[model samples]
Target: MNPLEIGSMVKARYKTGAYIGRIKEERGKFYLVEVLAVLKHPQQGDLHNPKETEGVFFHERRALAHHEKANIPKSAVSAFTDDIPDYPASLRTALQQLREDLNGQPASAYRDLALSNMDSLEKDYFG
Candidate 1:
């Protein structure tokens, strides 16, 4: 299987055909891709997370090369939230865990993104 790089768009083999999206995070065995579109209507739970995971992680074996044969329109595969920056899966998961450790309260979007630097930044800016 070809290795998928972060930010690279790929065609993932689905039951009926293929779904196209960008590779967001590469886990050891799977890639957390952001689905841009599918060949047909999505079945129930086809989307991993409507708010978080725009696409599901298909196995590396199921990933196909993105090409003209895919016939996915650029417009279909390019919708992304501009305000939220992409974070590595591990980092995001860790941050979520840290949030849990602290309390159940959700951090603001900016604070969430900067959690890794919270301690140092807090003294300089927050104080």
Candidate 2:
């Protein structure tokens, strides 16, 4: 499928809930995104290691695109969605493996990191 078509919904690897956004293209790839939101993180309150907190506090319209593996930032992500049918055993297995890999990490960690990185990229590229 042409990835950059408008009205297409894609799931970001980190952002939960199906990201119902349109696809945008840059140089030569597609990104799926929705209205941007301000994300906040709670302060850890550690003296030795100051805690960091952030969250989606503001809403802004934005677009996302997919980049080639080599061109993608260390932070760039692959699209995800729940539309996959139940018959794809191999794909399901791979997803299961990924779940296993993330099983032990704190749930908030993924959102915190992905949102932060996405914010930085947005500012750098679109600002």
Candidate 3:
């Protein structure tokens, strides 16, 4: 690859990929680039906010330009959650018992429940 010159637009490939503004400074094999456009990746949070990441230094292997092409395809990135717990049968049984207790209540008791539901709605929405 040709050495990058100052004030040249570039597409830098990292975990995902990004298009950036002109090259600012160089230190050995790394370039300090002004971030322009951040391409999205599935596993990562939003990196496109310029206020958050103003500029970044990238190695030559990760930095590219319009004239050049990537030799290897980008690696697949993803996020996975493995700690989610299953709902217990005891909790289900407790819910069933609560439903049964409510079902046996008289009409006036249900009226009170209805008023409680309305009160909850008012407190949540109007407060």
Top candidate (TM-score): 3
Give per-residue CA lDDT, model 1, range 1-110, as digits (tens).
Answer: 44446787665554433455666765555566665533332222224432131345322111222222333433233323323322233223333454354344466533
What's the lDDT for all of these models? 0.40, 0.33, 0.36
The TM-score obtained by model 1 is 0.29
Per-residue CA lDDT of model 3 for 1-127, tens digit only, reads: 4545665555444444443334655545555555443332111112353112124321111223323322321122112123322123222332334335435666553334433443443344336
Off by over 4 Å in 1: 15-17, 40-127
Considering summed lDDT, which 10 consecutive residues are worst modelled in model 2?
Answer: 35-44
| Count of residue pairs whose backbone atoms collide, per candidate | 0, 19, 0
**What is the alpha-carbon lDDT of model 2 when measured against the actual structure?**
0.33
Backbone clashes in model 3, listed as residue pairs: none
List the candidate 3 regions with Cα displacement exceeding 4 Å: 45-127
lDDT preference between candidates 1 and 2, better one:
1
How large is the C-alpha RMSD of every model relative to the true structure? 15.3, 13.5, 22.3
TM-score of model 3 (CA atoms): 0.30
